[model samples]
Target: MQEEAYHIPVLLAECLEALQIDPAGTYVDCTFGGGGHSRAILDKLGPDGRLVAFDQDADAAQNLPDDPRVLFVPHNFRHLQRFLRLHKINSVNGVLADLGVSSHQFDEAERGFSIRFDADLDMRMDARSERTAAQLLQTYSEQQLHKLFEQYGEVTNARTLAKTIVTLRATMPMQTIQQFKAAIQGVVKGNPNKYLAQVFQALRIEVNDEMGALKQLLEQLPEVLVQGGRAAIITFHSLEDRLVKQFFKQGSFEPEEDHPFENKKQVSLLKVITKKPIVPTMEEQKRNSRSRSAKLRVAERI
Candidate 1:
């Protein structure tokens, strides 16, 4: 199958430019959704250059290119350091991670990522994972649900929604998207579609441990890259972007208040290349709606 057919590469040109690719230098694509960015990186590499791509989703393996230069790792990017060592690579010249769900996952009805679909509430990016959205909804405490919806989804009536879910689940099991939607219909504010999307986003993040994986990936950047190596990450939402921005500036996930001593450190691990994140152009946003929320941040190893 063609790469674009799986998931159109958002901010393709911008990501390639941000990497500052060296034809003979090794690179990594942390989220190889459809091999789109991997293919572009391969096109720029010399015979000796190597590219290691990671994706936890089993469906992604079908789109892998038959190129010896590319090494596709069928695991999450959170294990980046371990995998690189397994390949006998100490450091890479660049790393690119496009975080969040791919268009392919959202379009696939059985994945239950889209609100448009009435499939079972299974949102595990890696099918091997046991937890599903249904399981999360059924198990999480009201307080836990409230925090997830508020923090991850930014849902306006998160507390009320959580309460509603807890009350409804006793009599109505939310095993499918339609059942889950009907359960929360009363608390949905403003636009139903927008509200449901945010709710679904929160559930998906919780089930897949998206934030946890991203934190792990960020923590390993300094160890994974050589001096002057570039890391270009494209985040689809503010939470992910904020973490990337803070890590690039502070070399740690903790807030400046939490790590007051960080300011006095002699050397920082990463130097923020893009002072502000690079956003998609109007034309690009129009062409691909998913690119609208994407913010690309680039950093160089110091």
Candidate 2:
């Protein structure tokens, strides 16, 4: 499949500007979904510049560009530090991570990323992973399901939905998206599409351990980036946006209380560049609806 057809890069110009790329600098595209962002970065680089791109999805490998300047790593960005070291790279001038599902994953029905498709309940970004959405639905306790739905999906009737799944799955195993949707048909609130989307979002997050991976990626940024190096992240939902916002602002995930020694030394490793996240313009949003929810946050290493 063509790269563009796989996934359209969100906030291309904004992300590039945020990175402030230097002609000969080394950069990392932490999530090289379809190589759109990586290609653009490559365009701005001189012959001496290098780009390292990461994607766990095997499908993305076909879209890899044939450029000596670009080193494609078939691994998850969660292990960014380890992979970079293996490549003899200690630090980078900038890093770009576009978080969330790629368009190809959602479009491919068998992946079970989109509620629009009726396929197997398999939502593993890396197909090699053990757990699938079906496995999660079958094994997670009621309380675990409730927490996942409420916290990750923000489903209004999470408790009731979790209970319903627990009761139904006892007799009918939900191995397919259709079966899962049928199981939850009674509890769907508001628009059916919206509700199912939320449920699927929660499952995908858990199956991929996305939040945990994002935390690991964020934690390693300061160490991976050189002084004045930038990190540009595009998040599809508020959960991710909040984490990036907090980390960039305070160098911690949780809010810090004022202390007597607050000003004694610098605690923040990153200085937030975008006071507010940069959203796509009206034109760009119209061009690609998936870009509508994207929030691009840029930060610089202090």
Estimate, for each residue in 67-111, the C-alpha lDDT of model 2 and write its tens digit. 899998999999999999999999999999999689999999888
Tens-digit lDDT string for candidate 1 (29-129) = 99998988999999999999999999999999999888999898999999999999999999999999999588899999999999998999999999999
RMSD of 2: 1.4
- Single out the weakest 10-residue window by summed lDDT for candidate 1: 258-267
TM-score of 2: 0.97
**Each model's number of backbone clashes?**
0, 0
Q: In model 1, what are the clashing residue pairs, if there are any?
A: none
Off by over 4 Å in 2: 259-266
Q: What's the true lDDT of residue 4 in model 1?
A: 71
Top-scoring candidate (lDDT): 2
The TM-score measured for candidate 1 stands at 0.97
Candidate 1: misplaced stretches above 4 Å? 258-267
